[model samples]
Target: MSTRPRRPRPPHPLRDRRSPWWRSAALAGALSVAVTAVSAPPAQAQLDDATRRITEAVSADRLRVHLQAFDEIATDHDGNRAAGTSGYRASVDHMVGALREAGYEPRLQTFRVPYFEVVAPATVATVADDGARTRLPSREVAAVEHSVSGEVTGRLQAVDTDGSPGDSTSGCETGDFEGFAPGSVALVQQGECSSGRKAANAEAAGASAVLVFGSGEWRHDRPARGSLEEPGAVTVPVIGLSYQAGVELLDAEEVSVTAETVSELRETYNVIADTGTGDPANTIVVGAHLDSVPEGAGINDNGSGSAAVLVIAEALADTEVENTVRFAWWGAEEIGLLGSDHYVSDLAGNDPAGLEDTAMYLNFDMMGSPNYGRFVYDGDGSGFGDHDSYDAPVGSGAIEEAFHEYFDSVGLASGETGFDGESDYVAFIEAGIPSGGLYTGDDHTMTGRDARRFDGRAGEPYDPCFHRACDDITNIEFQGLEEMSDAAAAVVLRYATSGDGVDLAPPVTGPGGDGPLMALLGVLAVGTVGLATLLMVRRRRRGPAG
Candidate 1:
């Protein structure tokens, strides 16, 4: 599929999407490890040398260069690095090129992408029976992504509400639009079915626009905004409103609204690179989504994480290890975890055995949100409870522990965030692949306690401009980037060198010494014994003087 018309790259095995939280704890005995089963770990000198080389190469300056490149890519193409655009393609190219330059053959996993964009602000103004009009702020009325452009004014008809969820599944089905006038606006309540089905039903019934409200679920993030399941298939003006706002519209006889959604079927890609020389039976999948939200440069939203992993992968090119370290830069993460989902789905369908070989999936979504907190994933189902349970695979907590130890070693206090299917690791974890990750913060307000522990501005979003035009290079926190990068490197190198909780062959001498390891070991054994005898003789002669 990647080769036919394009002939540009190898054909990537294709499949569909594979889909799949918690917080607070310390760097205590988080992960269980059997020290006896493991091979002798690299000596402290060897471990330090490996980490020092990779972390130094993966420095803040190198990270800044990547951030600058992403910013430039955004600046060169419409001020945003959103997926399916020239800017996003530039990002893929940049990441792949860097990996190739580092001596790794990177694969471009191409896929068709469905996208939605709000080119203009939508309007939602209610007209009362007495002709008094009250206008809600743009934030209060969110234009459902993928809605077509239109301006319509008519009576606001509330769809019927009944059965459980309490707020009514109003536009969920076509029958709910019964008795709805031809030019009226259908006010639907968020529930069972998707918003796309509601909008499609409303359009079929000749409704001019749609408004879907929350179903009293407070965790319903942005109760004022929601998106259709199939954006490319939607063709009407739709908006998501807060429950309160929807109630206000219920009493209105007339409602005027305008919505515009620029959507299309654009093709995109995921960049994949492997260390090419480790145990295929044991691979560590390291990844970060490379695309930004359409609103800005995305330096902090993911540039922080992206650049961190990117530089580490590059530095890892020279490091030695046993297990294969597969690095990926996913695209179109803002809309959903599409890129990573596709990668996992393809792997599951084509190379099911490969999934077993994957020891763990480590994610780094947002590493340097301006008002960042050092947050790690709740991999053992310890935080966020069953409500937001991620169903992390066995040994996932150990992955978290690796990171926990890294942070503690560096004297950085850390907190845990729910593995709530909020990022790219969703697919991997769902397929029974152990998953863990790091995130500073994003759009969520940082509490005073978090601020004190992590030392950042409280009462503000971890990234104030999370998905805004202001998320340029200036959006980064260099200190956070440095620490997180070092931590990420430490954890990656740790797992790469020693399979910890995973099954694997003995450690190789270096990056690609897999085949000749026994030979190298034999030579080293002879040399060690000879050197030891010589040193002992020399030390014996001089040691007696002491």
Candidate 2:
């Protein structure tokens, strides 16, 4: 049987609020020694020296350089850094140059990527007798366009109007158009059937136009094109709508709908910068998306994460951390994790130079919003209750623990968050490279529960104009940015200086993992020590002997 009984966390010494930062650290340290019987007294001393080193390396000059570069990518000579866009190419060049200037050799990882743009508005809905109506956006909605352009009108027909593809609409059989009439509007519900099949069925049945109900599901994101149908000889129009909207249209007595879509290919690029041997094997990767919605400058969406890594990399420049650090600026992340997916797929097997040396991947998405929730994803927790778990690699667990230690040292409250596919971390997670990072909230409103937990304003989005045009440099709060940057610096410094490297290892997991015994002990002991130090500092602040 396992002799390791679960350890309960010790009460926090700093929660008292009366204690100062140094005093709290001391108390936390004392408690840790009592519980673990592990004499880490020397470790603290070493850590302090390392912390000072990191602090000096992450100078304001380096941070300012990172921010300025980001401004160029997001503002200044502003342009869409869409994947395969000219702006993206320039952004890549700039990142490569910065990495080289920082004493790191950077390279580009090229892959074939398809680009898309909204050439025309998606249109398709029912203008019918019954109150039930259906509509879709120009792009997010389902739409189809012909090589030729023209509108067609006719008396509405209820073909396949029952909203079931099995009977009312044409089934798998393409020639099943035996009983339909000409010059009518074909209404088909979405299902297992393909768009091409549906269009063929409707065309064979002599329908002048067709309208499809949305795929049966709910979505908070914008709509987009579904499956494609090879351009056929028949010249008619087709469109799609939401499930609810489709039901309404089907129930209507008479309906008319229009649709349009652009099926063209475009190009994009993924920026890669490396600081070690070009060998992909046995490497550490940190990444963040470099693009934002067309509506705003994506300072928060990813600017924060990008800037954080840039600074961290710069500080690590002169350090001799065994593992090589490679930073990536992904393009077209907003259009789905396209950039990362492309890079991973290309490097998955063909890693000739041992690209698989990618032992660790740290992804930074959004980290600078003042009205945001900070989450340190528990990559290993089980998907329990309403939340799904992200199984972080052993190395990933260690990095997160390191961050906690850093923050705890500074007397800040940090929670272990879950790994959701809300950022670039998704790619590394899927690839099984232990992944972890930070996120402040986005443009979503914080509930009362969240506010109570995080102390941020509730009912307001983590980022007021998350993807809107207002996400500019002026909107960022300097204090918050500085705090977050400091945290980033601490985490990076700890990783670079620790002999164990960025990965902390297992049996010892993230905060409270396998139970909070050590954490509680450490917190208590550290807090006590911190409080004592604070008192000394205060006395000094008050002035010594006259």
Candidate 3:
């Protein structure tokens, strides 16, 4: 949720492009056949008996109990469980009590997070060369997150902004302000880099204030909500403007900007518990964020995920396991993945061995959207191309296969979602730890084809109340909760019991190939006989085309 400013959704790797209708239809038919052929034995049949029992013991009824508790906590503490609030403290106490009742000692990993709140609405206006002043509407100007508090009036100077699509290098470098006046206001466009960097450069260039506007593609009408990434990053007041507002002011002779905010560092914590019965060197980290945005109760945004992880942890408390299972409830995730980032950073710096000992991380976030789709992370980069900064860890593809196998064996149509660095899993993946997870979709709209595949409504957001005040207990879709939780439990137990085939070495090319469909079939055929039968069926199906 903190990946970017609040506006119309950006171009996501999953939803931005559409496949041809015919291709989608053909793929659906093929998936149906594959599911029918593989669903007979059921995916749990492949798991060890103990793993199957633990996964089955994960009851939706139990999960609902946890969700109800979270809802009540939010209600009692100001309608939210956001970090740096009494609601978050109460939520932490609740989790600690639950873990203690289940016979485990949970520890708190505390850290400081940058916090910023607008104390008053911001103001922006333009001045003509002839001394005429025109004020912009409040809706068109917003304070950038973590911006310093101040007011300034000065001549407006455009810093390399051309108002052209894809021309995002504006104000990225100090050289962009080569001839800028010392006390002038610098107007920059959002693109190619972070707002914090642009603001930092502008401040270094002697600008009294900074104004960042949206790219024409998004936030056209409303102010583009931007962030400075952390508090104290820049001294000058910074504000965001809508594309139309910025374009209108591009040629103005002067501008005035005012932003009043309280920005500082606040303390928060992550709840961590370890199942002390397995191999510590090959620990399986299972986690979900526990804090919500300030606007809502966040029952579906993350309460569902936290509840599922909690229930699974309780169910597996007494069960024997091969790898240690560490369950984490991350804090301050809604603000920018602060909790998980701090945890990973501390481990990497203080306990390098422990960081390396982490075999894999399994994340569960937003798993119960009302108009849901079963979306597994594209760990193999088969659906979404590999990210330049963070490539999926070597064994991530195997994790992807495990989930697909579980869903397919149960005859469920699952889709792949990109690892877009929007959640806690970003930390684990960036640390070179193999990671994968599930999401039930968020603010993105469900396509008509997806609606047919998942039996949900089209043209509507997966969760209409996402990040809003209405995301209480009523926002959850119980069916999505049940299905996603079961899959989560199964996959967690699978890795905890055995790390076979998920080695950290580079992936080996195989005869079964690495195509998505072929890789899925390879997982389905866990035994020699199953593989032979699948190969024969594949040959027969391709004979006509050949």
Candidate 4:
């Protein structure tokens, strides 16, 4: 890790509007839904003067200062903010210090993970019955997280893979491992269950090692390695092989593989800060993953999102709110969304009240990717909403609509990204919590249609420097960050000052589509109901930080 400061780089070249853009429709509908049946509505349901001030305060320059702080932390430490590393620690310290300086009480929650690293290259080799040996190309195989360190040589057995590249019940159950012998290497396909479960079955059948490969679509499928579904659950060595490499293994009668990984037990931290005002019974949880991938500083991959959140949090520090606004900077997001997942899991067991009161969980990951797209989560589940789509909770659609309205009010044409549960919002949705947020593309390449829709380079990855040493402050798109930050600020302030949507009954829709549900400013507050809220989280893990 290097601590020397690099040449100063401004986060962005272009500046977006600094003026506030609050849609009256949002104010009317948001509070109409928020106050549903609560008695005594606030004196003004309109966007308050305070709302305008805070949203206007979230300028690109303010955002730049925070990103620069992160860049300095990464530069002084190994050019990254990966969890469990000194850089990540510095990152946490910087964030906490900022919150403390801003007159907010910041808390740190600690957790441990089965940290993993690769000290040497892993290879897959095979042998024939005639004693001849063949070595596969290095690119054909990879080691997944939590894989035990070992070099095992034994008979190679191919599990049921439905004869496809990687589809169907490759290893859905124990029966898939029928006749498996101890010390033998089992080959499984990717599908149905998690990679951990597939490997677990092979290990249960006495297999010495497990080789998991991609499914039907070949290289188009997701990466071979991901954080284990259950990190400590698997005991044998597990490797991900490409389709061709896996087929070659199954074609051979014997295979000798070396899977050696260096792993350590380490503790990481999550930064928790909340507005010390508002209703404890109703909360709006806003979050952004704080750690970067180990490769680079991850300024655009996340620094952009985190920067916006930090500035917005500081801006709202002294604001009044009817509902508690809780902000969280998650750690170890790259490792498996473990930080946010732990918070939710721990909350479920420790303080059900907190989890229950959560009105919504809004995620902002990579919102300023160089080749940005204004993607709101598919809370309405239209794209991936049906039988095969992500199971988003009930109120998610409303959250999505709120973001869309804000974007529309600003003359921005926003598109939808399906809620595949790929970010901190995953746990929220699983608890049947409604969730929505913003995401610019990551390594996914922008397409022709994408260029037309977002006006970015179609052939390049959303963020060209994604997960690389180049994702420093120089990588951010100032305009993207500016607009997204404003939207973030607006939504936060709106929800913070409104009645709890969960505590109050659902607002009755007006006769027309998207019409106001209540009288114009200063309407009657609705009655109260049993309070409950929304949440979500999703990730395979392994990012500079998730």
Q: Which candidate leads the pack in TM-score?
A: 3
Query: Which of the numbered candidates is closest to the native, going by highest lDDT?
Result: 3
- What are the lDDT figures for the candidates, one per model? 0.72, 0.56, 0.79, 0.72
Lowest lDDT block of 10, candidate 2 = 1-10
Question: Per-candidate RMSD vs. true structure?
Answer: 12.7, 9.1, 8.4, 11.4
After aligning candidate 4 to the native by TM-score, how far in Å is the CA of 39 from where it should be? 38
Which candidate would rank higher by TM-score, 2 or 4? Answer: 4
Candidate 2 structure lDDT: 0.56
TM-score of 3: 0.76
lDDT, ranked from best to worst: 3, 4, 1, 2
* Candidate 2 per-residue C-alpha lDDT over 1-546 given as tens digits, one digit per residue, 9 for 90 to 100: 001111112212222111122343345444442333333232224246556566556554555566556556656434344565555666667677777888877666665544444345546555545555554444445554331123555555554446542323332355554566677777665556665567667777787876656555554233313544334433676665555555555555455554444344456666676655332344677788876665556666666676667777776777666556677878778766777877877777676344456767777777777775545656445321135545665667556655555555453455555665666777677777777666666666766655655567888876776777777665565445555566666665444433434444553334534333443444544566543443433233221111
Global lDDT for candidate 1?
0.72
TM-score between candidate 1 and the true structure: 0.73
List ranges where model 1 is wrong by over 4 Å: 1-47, 123-142, 151-166, 180-194, 208-224, 239-258, 382-387, 445-461, 499-546
| lDDT tens readout by residue for model 4, 1-546 | 011111111111111111123233323333444534433222123235665577679998999999999999999997899988899999999899999998899999999966776656677788877777787777877887777778888998888864465465777799988887778998888777788888888898999988887774657333366446544578778888777677656677788778787666799998999898998777888999998888889887688888888999999888878988889999888777889999999989999988898888888888788888777777766555763347677777667667665664445556667665557888888886778888777767777666666677878877778788999998989888888888888878767877644432232344443223222212333212211100000011001110
Better of 1 and 2 by lDDT: 1
lDDT of 1 by residue, 346-415 (tens): 9999998897788889999888777877777876565543655577877786676566555543445677
Off by over 4 Å in 3: 1-52, 125-135, 151-208, 212-220, 243-257, 385-390, 499-546
